[model samples]
Target: MEQESASGLSGRAGNAEPVAQTPTPDGAQIHEDYLARARRGSIWQMLAIALSLAIAAFSIYVLGRAVSAVSLSALRQAIAATSAEQIASAALLTVWSFLALTGYDGLALRQLNARVRYKTTALASFTSYAISFTLGFPLITAGTVRYWIYSQAGLTASKVASLTVIAGVTFWFGMAFVLGAGLAFHASAISAINHFYPLINALIGVSVLGAILAYLVWVTIRHRHISIKGFQLELPGLGLSLGQIALGVIDQCAAAGVLYVLLPSHAELDFFTFAATYVFACILGVLSNAPGGIGVFEAAMLKAVPVASEEALLASLVLFRVIYYLVPFLFALAFLGAHEGFHRWTSLREAMRGSEEEKVLEDEINPLRRWYRDNWRLRR
Candidate 1:
């Protein structure tokens, strides 16, 4: 009987099904491919970071060498020679530039169909640009600032990101337009600084302008959307696109004007020519990935603009840094701090008010509780 029971148990166990331990060939291959792609993405990211670092380091070295040529005493003399009128003009232009920057956010808000107030849009735009301008990585810094402010206004994370991207596009449109116009009209002037032939510069300028025109026509015809990593971005219509181009040009020109006013009166460079040089220098500085384009911008300016007074040029660059980059950065920091403090205070006040109301209710309920207790005791 024991032998028969053991055999029956063995047969039952054998009939029970078991799942396979190994994955199918196709499944295994898919997983391996996914891992390979991930590895490649990581490698590419590392390479990009390394390249940025290298460019920044090299630009800094160049800046250091350029500064060594000008004497501190001469620089001081040059700065002292600058008229109060010029300083005032530069300051005014700085304000104008920042104002135009606010329009970038405003336009982005319109594109997103987010009905945030004008004040909120200005705050988000100005603070983000101020912070990002001084910090090197605009994408991260600007996006964070926008998200922080816009989230309170009910903007989703993706919407904030789209806003940031749209704002960036506005800036590029302005930059490309100015650069192209300057190059096309005054290629000879630019060629003197960049060493490119006039014909080539003109061709490049024409190509850029053509591209912008084509984009404008395309958007005018119908709605256009671009998909990036599963995120869909709708392009603005013709009117909005025109507004972007205008704002961009104004902003870029104003920013460039800040430096232009600081240049020596004897520099002999016209506004259009100087603007192109300034834009080119800015592009190089941006590419270097240094904070505020610090070392790179100064180096490029020194190389491109032919100033008779090197000391004056150096002094102008120094003042430009202070007026444009440093002042805004400090102001943004203070504003952010004050904004956070005020928000906290408001929240605390509301919380305290709620707690007081709760205490008053509890106090009123205490008398009723005592009355009920007495009645129940008497009845018992």
Candidate 2:
């Protein structure tokens, strides 16, 4: 009876399956299901991308038609009437204004203690701006490009992303300064204009204020031991934050001046009014996301500056694009193309050298193999 009991226990123990072990067939089926879901997700993403591209193309076509309908004769006359000196000044200012944009990146880098060469910073900055100009989505391509370039300098992806975010904050801070100053100094001028959407102005004010408050809260939370990955920026004290705001105001003032210089000399608009109108127009253009805000920007300017004729507005907008968007865009393209060309050439040269080395090794190996075979036959 005891032997029988022991034998029964042993048999049961031997037949028992391990608790933690999963069956291979079941695991494989689960994996196959996951793969199917992933494929479906990939298809959805592709469809979304296709849809977005189609919409963007359609918007561009519609905008192009609006531009083409503007009187060419008036455009030419406005172009001719623009003083050579004013145009030259505007061009110079546009270049300098963009150069100043690099300062925002530099400041952020300094804050993050990520030391990089000036040339690298400039290239990253310019390439980012250029991509933003052409692609209409600044953050996507610009961030990717920055990661590619800055990663080589020992900066992690998170740190680069942090710097980019900080740079954007500073830019908006500057914009607020321009808007606030324009509002304060030209109260009468702003009140005189009829805006299609008064709510937009209110919204702009609220957004800026909300942003500042949010930044403050973020700083407080971070100070209490919450850490943000890749960005080691401390909440700059109130004074420092104010100083950044001041810098922003200066930047936008310079930007607005570039457009102001291109406007007709006879247009009875004060600096403050021009600044206010320009700010509104810029906001509209940015929201439209037209490539470099091309058609959208012109349309916004026309709407904002109601005193100016459509022809005059169109002419000024075109000239502004020429100075600010088109020229810088072309230069940035050339710079990127040259950089890429050099990298490609170097890669090709290395590939050729690798092929030559492989051929030499093959040549030596073939002779050795033949010699070994002949010796083996003799020995046999």
Candidate 3:
């Protein structure tokens, strides 16, 4: 009967012959566009996964060959020979690198106009990178962690996604800047790895820098925004863009310094030259999608950075992994666990308090209800 009445009322209101609802022309076109985009995205994702697997497999092969010649006793002695001062320097650089990492998320939030607290942004950035660096598949691990924290701070999925994209751009910008400058200034040194003419390497560096200059000029002239699948993302202005690059450079340099300081005193490579090699290895490691770029980075570093004592270099790499990657990863896990527990306890307490207040209100209302009922009976 209710359904019939509702149908009759709707029909009377229309006062015309009923017509079946169909999607509008624009709506249908939009749906088709979305489907096409999804199909393309899936294809790209598959290709990326296949590429990562290939890189990882090749890296593992390279690593196996490299380590076969290494002597365990020599490696142990090399590690023991590392001075307390070198360890202290590397540890300090690691701390500095992570501090710069926190700026990535903080700057990203500013770009999004999302007014989250610095501590909150720091927590998200540090924890996400720490977990993702050790776990592999940053888009999954880092994005998940960022979303988990940012969601509670009033950021939507789209906003968090945009923030992640912006932060990634910051990192790449810094990398390109570092690589460009290093290659331009010391192309001869880099030629040892690439076997290219110094002039050619310098040209490549100049080209990269030129591209960055072009982008800066373009943004300065007008506001730039990207529209991907109907979502609009505003680009940071020239000043903020510069800041992003600076922060990236600082972070990458600090990270590279950690490994550089740990290397044996006999290695004797310049900081700028070593930084270029470090960035290159790090990039390949990232592409391989292996946890902490395990085999890939070590393999690349071994191949690029020529040292007399491979065992000593390997020892330094091991210490770098422990201080820069493993320690932070463990710390982040414990911190995340504690944060989750505290949040749950706080929520439970709030819920109990709300329930208690409701119960108290009900207790006070019961007496008034009885009084009103008795008065009503007398009046009747």
TM-scores for every candidate against the unseen true structure: 0.84, 0.66, 0.83
Q: Each candidate's lDDT (Cα)?
A: 0.89, 0.72, 0.90
Which 10 consecutive positions of candidate 1 have the poorest summed lDDT? 262-271
All candidates: CA RMSD in angstroms?
10.7, 12.4, 13.2
- What local lDDT does model 1 show for residue 267? 46
Find the candidate with the highest TM-score and give its number: 1
* lDDT score for candidate 3 against the true structure: 0.90
Q: List, residue by residue over 45-147, the lDDT tens digit for candidate 1.
A: 8897887687778777877887788899999999999889989999999999999999999988888888999988888888899999999689999999989
Where is model 3 more than 4 Å wrong at Cα? 1-54, 367-380
Q: Please give the distance, in angstroms, between residue 7's alpha carbon in candidate 2 and its true position after superposition.
A: 57
lDDT of 2 by residue, 34-111 (tens): 999999999998886776555456546655665677778877997888889889989887777777777777877876
Estimate candidate 2's alpha-carbon lDDT, on a 0 to 1 scale: 0.72
- For residues 226-292, what per-residue lDDT tens digits would candidate 3 score against the true structure? 9977989999999999999999999999999999989885355788988988888988898887887
